[model samples]
Structure formats: structure tokens, C-alpha cells
Target: MSYGDEHRYGESARADDELFGGSGQTRTRLPDRAGDPYGGARRGGRSSSRSLVTVVGVVVLLIAAIAFANRGGDGSSSADDRGGEPAGAATAATGKRPVTTKTGGIPSGFTHDAQGAQSAAANYAVALGSTNMFKKDTRHSLLDLLYTPAAATRLRGPMDQAYSAEFLGKVGLDSNGDPPTGSTFVSRVVPVGTTVQQYGDSTAKVAVWYMGLIGMSGERSTDPVTSTWKTWTFTLQWTGGDWKIAADSQQDGPAPVPGDDRAATSDEISKAIDEYGGFTYAR
Candidate 1:
């Protein structure tokens, strides 16, 4: 199985038309948050200790009020220090800094909130779809930084199996995961937008809509580099002061109609990838 097949886990196969060319978009509804519905009743008791209990309750309430006030109305001030504004549309940037640190070349230290989750998901999409993911060392580093501990362990084996020697040959990569001397392999993911489908204090479901470029670039290349649009949904957990991927899935097209612009040549594409660098994506 290909990495696309294995990594997508239980998702059904998408059609070529849906994957490569399509109009409009499809939004997946996230699972609703379940609530605890059975709180046991407290037993009634009358004793001289009642007065002391009431005094402690008042002190606790005062402390909570001070904490809320310190947060400036909503409890998320720490994450959205600039104040969270409505995004208006599904694809708007939140106009806030998403992360401030890097670990093993992947972005780290995401704020503990929804915008932070969106940011982490977008950056991870770029990393996962990049040519670097074909190499074992860099791939392992990325996996460890971006995914939750359990998910990283579970996926490492299957993902290694999926990106096999045969698959490398098919994609024009050498056994060591390098492109031919005269050729350039492209596998960059550009995130166009992000949406928080569901959010909580400690978890978030975010989707990144992105365009990915893949294939080989050279005069003798049979599989010329091509682009595909996809929406990648990630389930994130607040762990170790950052958002980590708990799970993820992908679906095809919310793609727009192709433009009438002329296609660039193989040399031009290769030159561009080499000259241009990717951005630190934020939402």
C-alpha cells in the first residue's frame, strides 16, 4: 500500500475527478463533544462545622473571580493575547501569532487554544507533504515533534512499510531517498486556509485546506510534477505546552477551476523550488 493508502487509515478511496479536479468544497462535521450527565446528589448534614465550610466556599469563590478578571473576560486571554475576533469566513487568518519555538525543525510551543491548533495543523500539513518526509531521519524527527506519543509509535511502523523501496522507485527517488542528479523531486504542501471544526480547553479538531505539488522535475522525467488540492483534518491535543497530532485524515477537493495561465517549464519549476523558501504558516 502507498503512504496515501496506509496513512489515511480507514477513509474510503477518493475518485480521480474529486482528487485532481472539482468545483466547490465539502466540509466534514466534527463529532460533537459529549458531556457528563450524571452528577450524584450530595447527602444533607447539619453540624457545627457548617460555618467553617461556608467561609471556605466564599474564599474559593473570591479566588475564582480574581482569576477570571485577570483573564480579561474570556478564559482564553493567554492564548489570544490580542483578543480573539470573529474570522467572518471559514478561511480567514486569526491575526495572532501561532507559535514561538521550533523543535527538530518543526514548529513548537503553540498556544493552548483553537487558533494554536489551527496553526499547528497547517504547518504539519506542509511538513508531512514535503520531500523531507521521504527520508528516514528527518521523517522520524518530524513524526516525533508533530504527533502525540502514542500516534507516533503506532504510525512509524506502517508509514515506514508504506514508503518502501518499490514506492521510491515509482516516484523516481533513489534507495537513499534522493532524486537523480539532474532531477528535482517536488512534494510541497501550501495551506490556503484553516478552520476549527470543534474546540475545547484541551482538544481541537482543525482542517487545513492546501494545495500540494508532487512528482519529479527534469528533462527526462516521465512523471512531471503536478498539483492537487486537499483538506487535511487533524485532531490535536494540548500536551507538553504544545498542540500535538492525536489523529488525522484527508479528503479530496474543494478545488477551484484551473486558471488559463500558461504552464511553466520543468527547468523553471526546478529553479523556483530551489530558489524559493516556504513560509512559517500562521492562522
Candidate 2:
């Protein structure tokens, strides 16, 4: 797969670490008397002001009347047809089934719909971001299983060079991509949600919003586990009766506000990561 920490696109996410913050837009407020609550201009000509107020008042009154008429009706289900989800809703799992089959330990047999593309992208993100990608053998197996045959062949050498021994050492992994004794290497991606950017019968583009945990866990480890928020975009092709990753990219962001809780200890973090298994994330 064209997904990994060493990929330039993935590296770009870390460079954007300082950019994480609230996503709220900064509202531009006009001078107190310049604007009115009903979007009326305070200093306009009398004739123009009257005309605007008349129009706005009528519109507002109509809207109020409509709302009153439907006040007690079944408006709850209308949320499903709201075009896009509300702010902060896209980061939540949709509770749909993930996949129907697996091959070589990677999810397969996704449905032939937008939801399928989303599920494939989410699962592929998890596989690509796993610690297994640091080792040659596992990486090869994953590529063979999840990527198109041609893409896998073309990417094998570059991926091998990307996961070089020197790179492994910098991340607290030994030459064989293993953490030292009594230490557990953590490199997992938990997809919070997925979206279909573009979809068709044969090809699709899906983006997976995920939180990744990486670093080494141990009493003596200098690099403690940390989390990062990212969005992984996969270009998938329906080939051989499955969705295969043709190429992929990643970007940082859509990060939420950090919580006020205290940081967990190494043992606590390791235990949580171990006990809490990953999910087959849906749309």
C-alpha cells in the first residue's frame, strides 16, 4: 500500500501538528448600531429600510408559521435527509457493518456502494498504520492483500527503502522493527469515521478520519505512546471482486478540543491499548 509514516504525504501531517486547534470560525461582528438582530441595516435610507424590513419580516413570519404547523409532527427522521451531517457529527461511526470477508488478515468483500468504500478506506487505514508496516515481511503481506497487484509491485522497493533500519531506530525500534525487552511498540490507527469523497461502480475515493497511537511503552522507554489525529484518503479500485487500494494520501486535522483529563501512566496506557481491541469501523 502507498500508506505509511515514511510517505511524504503522511510526513506532512506531522509538520502540521502545530496547526491543530478549534475548528470554530471567527465571526465578524459589525458595529453595535450598524447591524440588527434580524439582519437589517440601521443607517439605511428610510424607504430602503422599510422595504428590507417588510421583506424580512414576511419571510420570518412565514418560516415561523411553517414551524408552528409542524411543531408536533414527526420531524425527527428528517435529520437523515439534511444533505450533510451537523458539525461534529461526521467524526462519529455510523454503526453499519464493516466487511463481510477477509483475505490474508485484511478486510475484504466490502459492499458495492458508498458505504462499502468508506468501510474499505477505514479498514485499510488501520492496516496501513499498524506496527506491522515497520517490518518487511508483514508489509509485503499487507500490500499483497490490500493493494492492486500492479501498485504492490511498483511500491515494494520504495516502501522497503522507506522503512529502513535507521528509520526504525529513530522510532525506538530495533533493526528487526521490534521494541526492546519489556517494551511494547505501539503503532495503531483507530478510525473514528469515514466519508465517500467520490463514488462509482468501479472506483471510489474515500477518506477516513482516524486517531493514531505510536511510540514505545516501557518503564525505561524515552518515547511514550502519543496520539495524533489525521485524515487518510484512499483511492480505491474495485478489482478482482474487491476494493483494492490504488494509491493513498493523508492530511492532518479536523482535530477536536483536547480534554482536561490528566495523562495516563505507561502501564495504564499499555494496558488500555492491549485490552481495548480495534473495531471494524463503518461509515
Name every residue pair that clashes in candidate 1: 94-283
- Separately for all candidates shown, the number of backbone clashes (residues 3 or more apart, or on different chains) is 1, 0
Model 2 alpha-carbon drift over 4 Å, by segment: 1-5, 9-95
Off by over 4 Å in 1: 1-90
Which 10 residues in a row give candidate 2 its minimum summed lDDT? 73-82
Q: Give lDDT tens digits, candidate 2, residues 59-79.
A: 898799767643542211112
lDDT of each: 0.71, 0.70
Residue 191 CA displacement from its true place in model 2, Å: 0.9
Instruction: Give the clash total for candidate 2.
Output: 0
Best-fitting candidate, scored by lDDT? 1
Please give the TM-score that candidate 2 achieves against the real structure. 0.70
The per-prediction CA RMSD against the true structure, in angstroms, equals 17.6, 10.0
